[model samples]
Target: MRLRWPVALLVTLLVVVLGTLMGSRTPAEAAKKITIKDSMGRTVRVPCPPQRIVEVNGDVAELICALGDAGKIVGASSYTLQDKFFTSRLKKAQDVGKSFTPSVEKILALKPDVVFGYGKFLKPEIIAQLERAGVPVVLLDCYKIKTMAEDIRTLGVILNRQKEAAAYIAYFEKYRKLFADRVKKIPVNRRPRVYLEQYTDYTLSGPGSGGAELLDGVGARNIGAGLRVPYPKISPEWLLAQNPDVIIKACGSSITSGYGEKPDAMAKKRAEMMRRPGWSRIAAVRQGKVYMLSSEIFTGPRAIVGMAYMAKWLYPQLFKDVNPAAIHKEMLKKFHGLELKGAYVYP
Candidate 1:
């Protein structure tokens, strides 16, 4: 109590030091939390990189795995895993229900701190359910393959894995150039009169679809160009009138209009396309120009796989040197340590 001024100051410093030594937090605890925004404009803040995450988009799950981290995800929409798209990655995943009904109970049980989802398909009600419960939901859209590669960077920024994301985007860019070079060399006469088959039937992609865009990307001419939404129904007779040189079947979601699954079964469900019985004379069938593609590959980040397949299909001579199947196999090895399957046409 009777200490001199200098001594008092020294004592105060000692007390402050002692308190800091006893009460200071570890470096890990002091790190700043990250806040991310979903495409729908909701903000998600996490105290730390979470141990459990719920994903609504199948492609987002694939991209996360490609970024080398699927172990962080605990929940997914049921539809994604039902198909070949999730073949290798579904071992640790659990179904949360369809895109329309992601099980609140199931997701809640996982106790996910972060929910990563995509699409306008996820209703506002489901999103509200998550936000109301204080779960941070971040939406990432990768509907187009071109934009899909860009979205990896967005996810990277959120997950704090920027380098991995950049690496993936860079990889996709290389393929884009490979496609462009081949496209640039094709002459007008050699460009195939391409038909973009959206469904098993005569549903054709017109001027404005991912399939149509990809067809254009590889310098092929779409016979259905200038139509409204692309994949409008076309009559078999009308299709024969055009006499397309090549036909690329690009499947999309919603395969159940009572459609049976098989190349020949296509005639039953898509009766309008039956090139026989009441109607059977399309040049595509007679010439054997038809090819089947995966439904999932038609949209989402998986579209990259679709695009690679498209490039190879459009110009076998040009891309004969490049093996699309081999590229996918290599992607699986480096990205997910899983094998690629169901990404192409089945015999």
Candidate 2:
């Protein structure tokens, strides 16, 4: 038998033995993992410094891009691709379809090491499907002010970009403290009554909404806070009765107001809102306090930028030295590596 041994058979046996020895150190053994709790409170084990990422949430994508890990993204939601910043940074990332209903097959095809999604939009079944296929899904809602810092910290740990994350947190805390200190000085009676409308007409953002949280953070009273639903459609009569001191309409992508975009569309929306029947009697309308805010800033890590603008709008005298536009410009240049050239707030 030894004399009759074929060269190909010997080679095959040698290769199999070598593979067996090396296979003892499996891929899981070779890759290190870290355990962290996602925004949804699920304990997930994700590879440290994930090389390939599929980010379904645009907000998280913004944070990832800001952290200077844009090159790690292999796939992104369609909404993320539409954003100027994300589009510029993630030009090569594959589109994984809609944020709410991302294509599982498309995401799997990208072979991402981890997936990041908004807690609200990512269904449980979708998460299970991804996990079953050996993909880890990390839900981080970067839009909420309350959890944004912690979310960023967790994200830093995952991306191995702790330094960048800390820097952003410091920037965030600076304005957060500034807003808190100045807003606390105003008397409750003097606080501006703000009516925050969503992209849809008559749809008001209530307690659970980011818009409501922003208004509350800036020491303004959200007229719709008492509503049971997060987004409630109210009658025009009810809005008229509120007589808000300030009106802020959140314009979505449909209205177009962001980097390199014009303000004409936002201006048109604001004018239409002001022209609504019986709107002239509203304090906000009469005093020209109606403002249109681009959703780009108001609902993500950049919400602080939107807060700066709101602070200036709600109390011009107090925040006179605080230039929201300058802060916004700095944020874009420092974090996203973009020059500010678009209108975010409408006159």
Candidate 3:
């Protein structure tokens, strides 16, 4: 079987090249991936159930943990990765940056297999940079209640947490349905015309906000819905005209950096600053329906909290009084093993 050396060498090289080409062409031979589109409608192919993933938002990071895959998250938002609830579960990972802006060099250095981020916070330029560095980024948006359930399902596909995600979605849907059915029992005359003051100044979290959506779901109407802006600038005159039955100041006017301020103190400060002659006559101010939104659950993973809050605010007798504080405690304990105390404030 011995042949000329030159001919034998040529034949061996051809065989090796043909075998490599065949392996590359075969799906079974190459690394298999499940193709899925991110929240932004960008096709991102995740390799093998995501051994290493980076999250740029607290909700996304928390979702990864709820999915029981903390080990896979290599990088997370500085705020979330440090949260006692999330950081205790994921000890090794640390601050990549804020959600909207992350250190490109640090992320590239990690060489992560997949990156999970929020649509509202993570910038498109950052996503582009990650792609340029040859990384896969999956953006998810769960900002509003309407699309929140769908967003959870999308996360399930990417993280392979479909079962847990489905269960959570089902739980929220069921809770909402039950709450709505109860609302239907209320006579039209008894339904409260509520004003949900999500914020002050330019950033009034409006009908599109989670709080307003919940109010609408439970039969209470939001006065801000007719304002005609995604987040309209509020004028004192409009408040006078609407004459809301109940005013829920879910949160105070906070610049992003100055969040978690007391609603009463903030209101007093605003009142002194703007001496609108008729402002004091508003029904909400007279009745003190204004309240603070004391938890992060209103938008993200705290659908249970939102339900509890709405139930208590709208129909206290029917709901046996939903305690947002207690619900926060249970969720933190079950999901992250942390105890919460007095997070929501009525004062």
Candidate 4:
């Protein structure tokens, strides 16, 4: 005898059958997810090998490009759009706006699989907003020397470019160890006292900052290391009183010195620093030890390149064999697939 099923039961059975036939995924396909603990210490589950990405920070975007996945970038911040290297590669990407204030609607419209941002700079609200929209946001700051290796490795895993990431890390370690081995041998008293200025005059890079770490990595004693804040502004008299043995100015976008630019702006910045009132008595000025470094190299993923220059400037005899320009060119060629054509340091 045939039995008649209840309408509700029949509907449930039909729905289940249709769902299995139309929406079921294989185990391998269902498991295509990666769990990542971002720089902010938040665990995020991202789709494996994100095909479309929105990178809000230029430094982080540079890392993505270095990983050989520049083609996957679908949206970028204004900073990345303005960068010659990024513009050349990400010609088809849409600019969502500034890194600090990205347009959520614009990013959502792109249907990105993942978004990259700097934990320290991008607001938590923006990250939350993206997450609510079913988009994953990974905070990775590629600037700090201490965490750079881990950050790159994480990116490598997320992008399935483990080989490229390992190579990049090895390259960074080569120079890092070169500087570390040589710097460690020098006595503490022999290390130069350095005053590293930020983008603005009288603004200093203090403890816990990437700039301060760069100086420390090269065995230079940062005069402002004892400051309570990361970036503190001091009076001119205070700067003169420090009498730092070496003065290094970090120039940002205000001074063009990186990627298809001339060294004239850096030269002018150096000369202006040299002409500061009462700075003539400073040891750095008296001995012609004042130098200018573009923020492009000193504050981001290529900070080691800046460190190489700093090492040479502070201890010319010790780092004579270390050519920062050569290293810069090699990095550009090997990682970013670009030729070195701009001035990163000045005479």
Top lDDT hit:
2
**Per-residue lDDT of candidate 4, residues 1-347 (tens digit):** 99999999999999999778758553323437889998879898987788889999888889889988899899999878987767689998999999988999999999888999988889889988999998899999888888889999998998989999999999998888888888987888889999999988899999888998898889998999889998999999999999999999898888887888889999998998899899899998999998889878986889889999999999899999989999999999989878999878888
Query: All candidates' lDDT scores?
Result: 0.67, 0.90, 0.67, 0.89
Q: Write down the lDDT that model 3 would get.
A: 0.67
Best by TM-score: 2
Better of 2 and 3 by TM-score: 2
Tell me the TM-score of model 4. Answer: 0.90
Per-residue lDDT of 42 in model 1: 57
TM-score of each: 0.74, 0.91, 0.77, 0.90
lDDT of 2 by residue, 1-347 (tens): 34788989999999999888878653433578999999889999998888889999988988999999999898999988987766678989999998989999999998888999989779789989999999999999999888889999999999889999999999987897788888987788899899988989999989888888888788998898788988899999999999999999998878988878899999999999999999999999999999999988886899988999999999889889998889988988998878888889999
**Order of candidate numbers by TM-score, starting with the best:** 2, 4, 3, 1
lDDT by residue (tens digit), candidate 3, 1-347: 86666978999999999887886442222445788876677777776566777888777777777767888777877877545456467787856887789988778777688788876568889988998887878877765667778888888876677898897788667666777878887877788887666656424546556667777777887776666565667776776787777665544224111122334554554454234567567666676655445445555777567667767776788888556667667666666555664334454
Candidate number with the higher lDDT (3 or 4): 4
